[model samples]
Target: MAIGYLGPEGTFTHAAARELRPGADLVALTTQAQAIALVEDGSIEGAVVPVDNTVNGVVLPTWDALLGTTASRIVADTLVPVTFNAYALTGDVVPEVVVSHPHALAQCARYVSSLGVPSRAASSTAEACASLAPGEVAIAAPVCAELYPVATIATKVEDGAGAITQFGVVSRDDVRPTTDRWTTVFAALPERNAPGSLAALLTPLASLGCNLENIVARPLRGSVDYVFLLFVTDLDQDREASALDSLRAQCSGLSVLGRLAAAKHSRPDGASGIPARLAPVRS
Candidate 1:
């Protein structure tokens, strides 16, 4: 299988892509939009794209890209832990010249503040680590040591290893099993601005026993409407209408952004990427 992930490699999305497919062929793209486009155009069978980070909240740009697409998705998420670190080139341990992905920098804001280092943003952690010299410097993961000619000055710099990210496996069509499947999508409701309009439309969903796994509002820059990324769990072909009806009666400007077909991604026998007790989470 061909897999696409946001990368220059050594990014969490890159890690997720490899973990999800094991030995599958992987392609790395720069931005979330690029990853989604690869799937939309059939260049790859699926993509590993960040949906949200525990500390950074929702990645709006990614959500927007998914919302804008007609692409289908996999419900199973690759939950990876985020632990930002400082990487330096060999003997280059100047705290003032730190380099890293902007998101990484933001996630470890406290550590950065304590160090009071001036950081330069890079596209990926590997790239950032590559730009540095070892000695008195470090990066988030020791897994990056193979790519960059640097040494880690510290590990797990971010307070509490609780920070995590959940990524969506984007595909061209629904690829989940009918049993235990959950569907997710982005939609825009008409009359989103009208008072009680959204509630009136969604009230029936509660009555119909639709359990929402997620419901997030996204800001639309050029329009007054808000986009909704809704994840409905326990979906069957027989029950598609109740969800659709909820959209129609309570919402006017409704549009399906994308759909996700999910099932529990099983752990491979003898696989040991992360411990079950400390399975990474979206903090």
Candidate 2:
């Protein structure tokens, strides 16, 4: 099976794709949108796109793409624990400027600011690593040093060690219910100027005993309307069905992106325990 990922090769999304399906054919596209487009058009089985990062929050472009598409749904997800480093073509010279993807720059803001040099955005961290000049540094993964003719001048340059990025594998079909640890849903509330309208939409989830993991509101393009992305956990089969039925009645538009089992190895503590929602039931 062929899977697509945001690339020119050597991106974190590419790494996540490999992690999700080892030994599968991987197609690299220039942007997350392009990868998603391929999956939506049936050109590829699935595509891995970064949805959220610990340091920078949601990836806006990917969020927008998810909202804009109707044929695609998130089928699986993997968390990539990231720690960036500064790479340079030559270690001897002080870098006059730095380059990396916008997210990388944001992740290592403190380190980048400390260098007191201008920074430029590249399509990906790997591309930035490959494009560096003698006095230019790239904030990239340590693997970039091996992939390109770059030296790791600085290591662990991110603001914190617990920097994790969440990548979603989007496909044309919805994922079947598994050991449901997380359910990702997107909904468009009826456009009303009333202050309590958003809260009213969320009331059903609470009543159904669904625990919300995260919620993000994005303004629809060219309109005052908004769409909400929600991650809910600790929902059993009954609650899941109930929540969706209630949501459908309340929302102008609703999509159940995926019901997924959390990645075991993706946990920050490196433990292989099951997520709380998927814990063994007591007799």
Candidate 3:
């Protein structure tokens, strides 16, 4: 089977892809949109891409792409722990500039700030490592130091050791739910905005006894309107069908983004036993 991912290699997405389907043929696309496009075009069977980061929050591009695409659906979800390291070419002089992907830079903001140098965004952390000059530094995965000719100057630079990112495996086929604790759907609310509109849409889930996991809203393109993406659980075939019926009645458009097994990681203190990273959005 062939899979696509955002890359130049040495990216966290690449790591996630490998973990998702080890030994599968992997295609590296320059952008997340390109990876999804390949899946849409049937150039590849699926694509693994980051959707959210523990510290950096939602990845806007992936969310926007999910909202816009119709040919692909999320097949599985995975959480990869992240640790960033600052690397530089061998030199006695301190680096004058730092570079990395925006998310990586954000995760290591404190360390980057301590460097007291200007920072620039790269297409990917690997790309940044590949292009670094003698007096420049790249914040990237520890593996980058070996993949590219750089030395690790700092380690575990992320804000916390708990740093993790949520990745989705996207394919053209609908995946059957493997566990009761599975499934997430994306729905677009009606164009007309009014009081309690959001609540009305969510009422069905509550009525059906479905646990609303994560809920995020993104502004519709070139408009003041907004659309919500929801992750839900505690649903069976009958309940899922009923919930969809209610949502279809209330929404302008509805799409089952994906349905698969949920992640196994969970916080010991969490009441729902859901992974802290996947915990439901509370009011």
Candidate 4:
């Protein structure tokens, strides 16, 4: 089966796709939105796209595209280190303009700003590196230096140390979880506009022993209304069905996007005040 990735082969998403599905045919797509669309339309068996980064928080464009449709589900996820190398034709070259993906530019903001050059956004970091001209530097993965003619003038250019980006694999079909630890992403609309409405929606899940991992409210297209996206983890696998049922009852509408591998630190710990499930059983 074929899988898609945000690429020109040197992108971190390409690395993530490799990690997610080794030995699979990988197609390079110019944009994550395009990858998501292709997955929804059955153009590809699946696609790997960045969901968020430790340094940049949420990838807005990715989330916006995710909120646009519920047909595509996140089936798997992987993390890639957010490392960048400033590339040019020569080591001594002074760049007049910096180019890379917007998120890459942000991650390496300090380095890009130190160059005293304007930054341009490319479809992907590898694309920027591949298209670099004289006097223009691209902040991309070190792999790009080998993939293209660029030389790494600066290594480890990202602003933060130990920064990582989380990538999710999107597919049209439901994928069975590979592990018991998983996070369910779903969109919900409140029954009404009330101060306690949002709080009330969580009450049901709380009662069902589910942990609210994360939540974001995104504006609806062409309207002032908002849809809440929730990331939930169940302490007990047996309670998941009832937990979803409980949360759905509180919302006017709800859509379960996917249940994928939970990111590290999302699961409950002894220190979290939420007790970890002991002797957990799954069917």
lDDT score, candidate 2, position 106: 93
Colliding pairs, model 4? none
Mark the regions of model 1 whose C-alpha exceeds 4 Å error after superposition.
Answer: 133-139, 177-183, 211-213, 233-240, 253-283
Q: What tens-digit string does per-residue lDDT give for candidate 2 at 79-170?
A: 88898988888778687999999999998999999999999999999889877887898998877777888777899998766678888888
Please give the distance, in angstroms, between residue 223's alpha carbon in candidate 4 and its true position after superposition: 1.8
Candidate 1, residue 87: Cα displacement in angstroms equals 1.2
Question: lDDT by residue for model 4 over 1-283, one digit each (tens)?
Answer: 6899988989999999999999999999887688788877777899888887765666767767766666887878877767888889887887899999988988888998899988888999999988898999999998887799878888998776667788888888777577866778778888887788889889888877688978888887797778888888753356667766877778888877767575654322233323367644678
Misplaced by over 4 Å in model 4 are 234-236, 265-283
Which clashing pairs does model 2 show? none
Error of 1 at 198 (Å): 2.1
User: Each model's TM-score?
Assistant: 0.79, 0.87, 0.88, 0.87
C-alpha-based local distance difference test score of model 4: 0.80
Q: Which stretches of candidate 3 lie over 4 Å from their true place?
A: 91-93, 264-283
Model 3 Cα shift for residue 203 (angstroms): 1.7
The residue pairs found clashing in candidate 3 are 213-280
Give all candidates' CA lDDT scores.
0.66, 0.79, 0.81, 0.80
